[model samples]
Target: MKTVVAVYTGQGLADPLKKVFQELLPDVRLVNIIDDSLIGDVVKAGRIPPGVARRLVQYYRNGEELGADVILNTCSSVGEVADDAGKLIGIPIVKIDQAMAARAAASYERIAVLATLPSTLEPTMRLIEKEAAAAGRAVTLVNGLAAGAFEALNGGRPEEHDRLILETAERVAGEADAIVLAQGSMARMESKLAAATGKPVLSSPRLGVEQVREVLERLSREGEAAR
Candidate 1:
């Protein structure tokens, strides 16, 4: 069985992504390494400082140590450094947004990246720009921050959190070609966002799993060729 190492910088993603991997590619082995503080520290710092980025390199090295076929970084902020890790690890390092970003870039001329956190906004936009360039397309990014939504979730008001994002998504729907949710925690908004906006809503969970499957298949093909 091929092993996929999921490095999550936040909590609650493991269960959802596990279900995703199972539904998408059942035979592939999945391992999760969660560091909730990784997101918290980055959020507090307003960006990924050098120390935080260094820790992510260690995380990638740890995945390499585990003999992972591919490494999936589940947070967008730290996902900015995934390419740097890919250079060191020699394995496919997939940011959760990569597949989604590619799809959005290919299909949309104007992409609205909706986020509850400021720290998540810039990294996701940068990712989309890189993805658009790779696809030979151009995109205009609309920054939609659901103000107070993150605070509501942290304050133990998930319903309020959902409501805020739903409202924000509706208001911002007409300004872009499609809506892309930036965080795994916001995956729940996919259906709601699509329903309300009647626009394409791209989230990372399923697409990210599909990307892992594709990478594993390529690796398997390479191994067979080598043998």
Candidate 2:
């Protein structure tokens, strides 16, 4: 069976992707490479060291050796690194939120981004701004960061965490046409947040999975033709 590699900095991102993959790509095998130790405080602080990019490249190389048809990095903090890895390898490499960012810019002129970690919000905003410029659209980006939301999610109070997320998301409701959940983990509350705001909820993991599946399906088709 063909396989794809999905690298994550923490289990929070991987757990959701597993659910997504189960629903979307059950036939395709997935190799999960999770490194929780690297998470540390960098995610909340919103910083990525230069070395992180190199580490991502190494991960991609290993995935290539394992014959992965594609590689996906689930952390938005290392998005640029993920792109860099794509350039280093001929095979497909995907940044988790790229497609979500592009879609968010297209669907909504005013967008609210909800993130648990401060570091994720700014980079995500920059990504949305870049995508909006590429699409020739101007978008208003709003931030909805709830204090301790990340802790709540990781601390095993998902319902409470989602309540806070929905509350914050609702505050930006009238201000934006849609909401973008910056991290895949934040995707857990996407539907609830959308319900609270009565606007479309865009999540990185779902969109990213869809986009990567498109690429991989294309690759599969091309390979079949070549055979």
Candidate 3:
């Protein structure tokens, strides 16, 4: 079985992402490494601190040592770190939001990225911009922050969190060709936001898992060719 190591900075997306893996790559072995405090440290620093980045790199190396065929980074806030780590890591490192961002950038001229935290929102936006530049596509990005929603969710009021996200999506839908949820945790809102706004809503988990499947397939083919 192909082994995948998922590194998470928070617990919010763990179950959802695992479900995706179960559905999409059931034969693959899934291993998780979660450090919930990493998110707090990033938020406090307003960016990924050097120490935090080093720790994340260590986690990637640990995954490699565990014989991971691929490493999945599940935090948009530290996505750039994942990019850098990819250069040093032997196996593929997939940032959870990368495929979603690439799709949004390639398909939409006006994309709105919604997130509860500035830390996630900024990195997600930058990722889309980077993808767009690589594709030679000029895209306009709109930032939508569901202010207080993260706090509400952490406070055990999920309904309020959903409502706030919906409100933010509604407000930005008028100007955006598509909506992208900046965090994997917000994936549950994808279909609802698309239905409510009549727009394409992109989320990370499924797309990221699909990308992982693609990588595994490619690796399999290469292994066969070498034989």
Q: Quick one: best TM-score, which candidate?
A: 3
Tens-digit lDDT string for candidate 1 (71-104): 9999887887887778888788988888988899
Q: Count residue pairs with overlapping backbones in model 1.
A: 0
Least accurate stretch of 10 residues (summed lDDT) in model 3? 43-52
Worst 10 residues of 1 by lDDT: 77-86
TM-score of model number 2: 0.91
Candidate 2 vs candidate 3: the lDDT winner is 3
Model 2, CA-based lDDT: 0.82
Cα displacement (Å) at residue 168, model 1:
0.9
TM per prediction: 0.97, 0.91, 0.98
Q: So what's the TM-score on candidate 1? A: 0.97
Q: What is the lDDT of residue 182 in candidate 2?
A: 85
- Please, what is the whole-model Cα lDDT of each candidate in the order they appear? 0.88, 0.82, 0.95
The best candidate by lDDT is: 3
Query: Sort by lDDT, best first: what order?
Result: 3, 1, 2
Q: Alpha-carbon error at 96 in model 2, in Å?
A: 2.0
Clashing pairs in 3: none
Which residues of candidate 1, in runs, are more than 4 Å off? none
The positional error of residue 151 in candidate 2, measured at the CA in angstroms, is: 3.1
